[model samples]
Target: MENESPDLQLQGLHYLTGAPVRIAIRQGRIAGVEPLNDPPASLRQLPWIGPGFVDLQINGYAGMDFNTLPIAPHTTSRLSRALWSEGVTSFFPTVITNSEDAILEAVSAIARECEEDEAAGSAVAGIHLEGPFISPEDGARGAHSRAYVRAPDWPLFQRWQEAARGRIKIVTVSPEWPEAEAFIRRCADSGVLVSIGHTAAAPDQIARAVAAGAAMSTHFGNGAHPVLPRHPNYLWEQLAADELWTCLIADGFHLPDSVLKVAMKVKGDKALLVSDAVMFSGMPAGTYESHIGGKVVLTPQGRLQMADQPQLLAGSVKMLPAGVSHLVKRGLCSLGEAWEMASVRPAKRVGLPFSAGLEAGAPADVLLIEWGDAGGDGSEPRIAGVYKNGVSVWP
Candidate 1:
């Protein structure tokens, strides 16, 4: 072994195969790897090691709402460190529907945080604009404020993009508006990814949006009507379109086991797992007031809901790590496969280079997990350690 030896080395059973492997890191990136075919002379505690998870639709964490006014630059740095504890190394700080001024302010705040600190900057892959150009229908609008619901305005979006310093990678909108197709093309031409969400667009409208370069669906089973026609609904429409990559909030509350199973099978590698987590995530179980979802309650069952209407979910409280464990527990997918849905696949969709597992030249964004009775005990997989760029970043 060389001097300054990688900062650390983890020997563990492969997450999928359950075979021992040695992973080495150096200078915040994967430097080497070798199979440990035989047991070491003296063994130490080992856990499953894999690439860190990436969440494309995270809204906020630890009481920080991205849309909340007067956002501070330090908030992004704090949230990034907080998410590390949950096995997330990469995520988008999503800003949902809001007044144009509020949107620009929030973007500028987030941009300033990333622009100032390299570590904070790397954690924020891009900005996610989830609305202000979505359906006005009640159920379809989800928890986004109705007052802010309006048509798409390219000029206004350009201003927000300027404030975001061109870090606005994804935009979610409904294709129901007359200007939808053109707006999608404009966004795509500018190298931004457009997604459909909070929508009641017809099948033709959805197809047109896809034709105009809308590449994905945001939280497919959510931000829509509870009931739908058997055939031509937005859910089915997006599902059938191979051109559209779909994101699923697989935290159990957001999807039924049956639906999740079918969607995973159909989309195959294209399906991505997203937390869609709110500010209350990573917090204790209790009724908590939120800046966005007023009087939201965080239940012991891992469900975050409105206190006034227990039936309606106020975004998810489960982080991406829990979502991965839930899929494995429900027999929806294997540990390796489920983890990829939460990590590599999403990275690929966004054109980010990611390693399949620890490998030479790969960024040292990794997780050491103890797969403790996670399924039988109805508990989350315990994270033994989290590393970003080869450094222990988790408590």
Candidate 2:
């Protein structure tokens, strides 16, 4: 079916207040929002209006893998359209650590897809480069190949940026290297967000990275050594840095509830959620071969771990909706707060227009959610409808 006409009105319960509202749309943006005076017999009959999710770190969805060598044609476009049902209106296709040439090809293909496909062009906020410039240590490196890991190389990054048509908005780096501070400063100055992740950096180095404009932390508390010094570790340093926004993978398996609560409390609104999901996100639970980890298993419980060692996680199989559900289920945060962390907050961090959410004059990138059971039951939100730029795109 074709999308709804740009000029239209949608009636639903407001996501934050749970009050009925009528949202006016015109010319692909929200014209106004007004509260409904009449009391409905059943609020469950109406969907909840909220911002469409904006994922800052997702490698792929369903069967598509962004980091796979020779990314298939239209893979980016297919991924973009696939995410609408998942309530993701926008996302950053993540390209992880690989050989210089492989990285270039992957990004260039994504850039081409954006240039050629209108839907992809609008949905792909930017490219998230998750490394070659990171720690070479075993645990901190996560699944990134150690052979490709090296010191921060601006020239090499520049080549990737050029291939991506300047769409590399975020770069994850470890501040452990001697040249990291300068590299981070350069990326910040060039309008790229520098995120600290998969790191073995000391407290001083982490502080310096923040001083040099490291704006965010990637999947905080996951990609790191199993053990750390009791004090003066990178985790403590990032939490103390008020300017650093933290992104957590609230997939339940990634971080414990206690840690999630503390980070959310410390970072407050600056705390965000990211799926950091891989190609197996929407696939059935089964054993699969991954480019990052040779063999991995997707458990029915939604945990993705190495086949050989179930203790080690390969990547996440859940999406943003599941993360929001986990946070709410764990009583870590309220439904509204959890939604914003996965939606507007992440958009706000990236300076995207979708940050305005249901406000007037913001782009009408919205989700109509069936959240009737969310208040008490802690079930995942059912995305009944998704609208991008005021046009209904999902059933």
Which candidate leads in TM-score? 2
Instruction: List, residue by residue over 305-395, the lDDT tens digit for candidate 2.
Output: 9999999888998999899888888789887899899899999999999999899999999898887857576556788999899888897
Residue 167 accuracy (lDDT) in model 2: 94
Best candidate (score: lDDT): 2
Report, for all candidates in order, the number of backbone clashes: 2, 0
Candidate 1 accuracy as TM-score: 0.94
For every model shown, what is its TM-score relative to the native structure?
A: 0.94, 0.98
The digit string of per-residue lDDT tens for model 1 on 237-295 reads 89999999889998889989888888888898889899988888878999887787779
lDDT of 2: 0.92
How many Å off is the CA of 223 in candidate 1? 0.8
- Candidate 2 local Cα displacement, residue 113, angstroms: 0.6
Colliding pairs, model 1: 6-25, 28-389
